[model samples]
Target: MTTITLVQGDITRQSADAIVNAANSSLLGGGGVDGAIHRRGGPAILEDCRRLRASHYGKGLPTGRAVATTAGNLDARWVIHTVGPRFTREEDRSELLASCYRESLRVADELGARTVAFPAVSAGIYGWPMDDAARIAVETVRATETSVEEVRFVLFDEPAYEAFARQVG
Candidate 1:
């Protein structure tokens, strides 16, 4: 059976089987969680991502798809980076954001990852509502067909933490 866990913490510093990094198309590393992951993961991750980024062009985003990398400083063994859609319109954002969870699970299954950690997609710079994002996350996770044993939502703040906790509970 699969388990969905709501944890108040940092995705960039998780100690699970795999952690999801919300990245841009560049995937080279930008600000926010992306910068933190890159800094901690060191240069090897960037080098691997550069090549992965080239071959995995349009594959970077749209929510559902994910790319894999070695976990540098993180406690996990692998990092599965996913790009979530940012929209002023929910037209595609909803489906895409939900897919982020689904696809991440699929990738984890492929990598034999039994546990996964994620940051709240699009909630920060993407401006997605915290409650809505948490709902989508829990729902999509509930729908996954992979053998992911544990799913952890790592929140960076108290508000986000409480929001997810309320939804999960």
Candidate 2:
């Protein structure tokens, strides 16, 4: 069983075996956690992303899907990039959001990663409600089976931390 932990801090600063980046479909680089990871992890991450784009991810990474890249300057050995679905009331995309966490773990497992740090996924500019996002993340991670020993949801703010805490508790 994996132990879930919540921390109120920057995901980019977390030292784990892998860090999950809530990336856009392009997977090249975008705002929020994506930008932060690329900025701090240096050009190596973007170079890997570009290579992915040119090879396997020609159409860009699909929503809810995940891929791994070198961590570069970050403390982690690898960075797992997963794209979260945009929030839209017209359609129920909760499963897609959930898949972001699930797929990240799958990739982490393949890489023999024991600890993973994740951001709030779709809760940022994607417009997912923070509370609901927390619920999906916690529930999905708890339900999924993997070799990962610890999962850390690293939040950038107090409200986000509290929301995840409620779900974790």
Candidate 3:
């Protein structure tokens, strides 16, 4: 069985095959997890994003989609960048939030990654509630089909850890 684990720490420090970035559509880098990944992962990741922007994703990566780039200075071999939709009351965008996890795993599978780490995605600056974010993350990863042997949710704090723990338990 594919194991799902939760860790409370910096996602950038995890030594998995790939780490999912809760990126903005620009993918050039933004606040929260995106900024941390790009900053710690170094210029190589940004260079790749620039190339991606210059080449294919000029309009920027659409929300709910994912693309991979080199991990740069991080322990992981790859960084899977996915844009998470901002939470809104006008429409239900829960599916898009779930897609971040699904698409990241797809990218990881393409890279033959056996283990991957993910953040809380929209739960941060995008304002998706932590409980709902945890629910979608866990449920989507549990239901998705992939070759990844381990999926770790590398949360940054105690509340995030407890939220994911409730879902995992």
Candidate 4:
């Protein structure tokens, strides 16, 4: 069975096989995880994202939607960016959020990524509670059907790490 690991550190600092960015639909750059990833990866990511966002809109993110730019300043080779839900409206937040995780894993599998890392999507500025967000993340990873051998939750705080650990460990 595939397993998840909880690491207490910065998601932007991780060097997993594929690192996921909780992006806005625009995919250019926004606050929270998207901003952090773009900043660490440098302007190249934002440039590519700007191109993609120009024509990309709506749901499901085109399934195999991903772009491989230079690591900029980060450790990973490819930054697999995916647009997750905003949790702004209280409708179908769970399904939309779960779809983000599932779609990210799908992208990773296509990239032949054996290991992938993710942040707590929708938990930062979207206002989802930490534990609730962690539950969705853990469950989505478990439910996903992919070739990935390792999944890491690169957390920003001790509380988040512990919550993910309890589910995965």
Runs of candidate 4 with Cα error greater than 4 angstroms are 55-70, 88-90
**Every candidate's CA RMSD:** 1.7, 0.5, 0.6, 2.9
Which candidate number would show the highest lDDT if scored against the true structure? Answer: 2
Provide the lDDT at 74 for model 4: 76
lDDT of 1 by residue, 66-149 (tens): 878999777888888888777566375798889888888989999999999989977888788889988898888887788999
lDDT tens digits by residue: candidate 3, 25-138: 998999999999999999999999999999999999999999999999999899999999999989999999998899999999999999999999999989999999999999
lDDT of 2 by residue, 3-84 (tens): 9998899888899999999999888888999999999999999999999999999999999999999999999999999999
The alpha-carbon root-mean-square deviation between model 1 and the true structure, to one decimal in Å, is: 1.7
Worst 10 contiguous positions by lDDT, candidate 2: 23-32
Ranking by TM-score: 2, 3, 1, 4
Higher-TM-score candidate of 1 and 2: 2
- For candidate 4, what is the lDDT? 0.76
Q: In order, how many clashes per candidate?
A: 0, 0, 0, 0
Q: Which regions of candidate 1 fall more than 4 Å away from where they truly are?
A: 58-62, 90-92
Q: Which consecutive 10 residues in model 4 have the weakest lDDT in total?
A: 57-66
**TM-score for model 4?**
0.86
Candidate-wise lDDT, in order: 0.83, 0.96, 0.95, 0.76
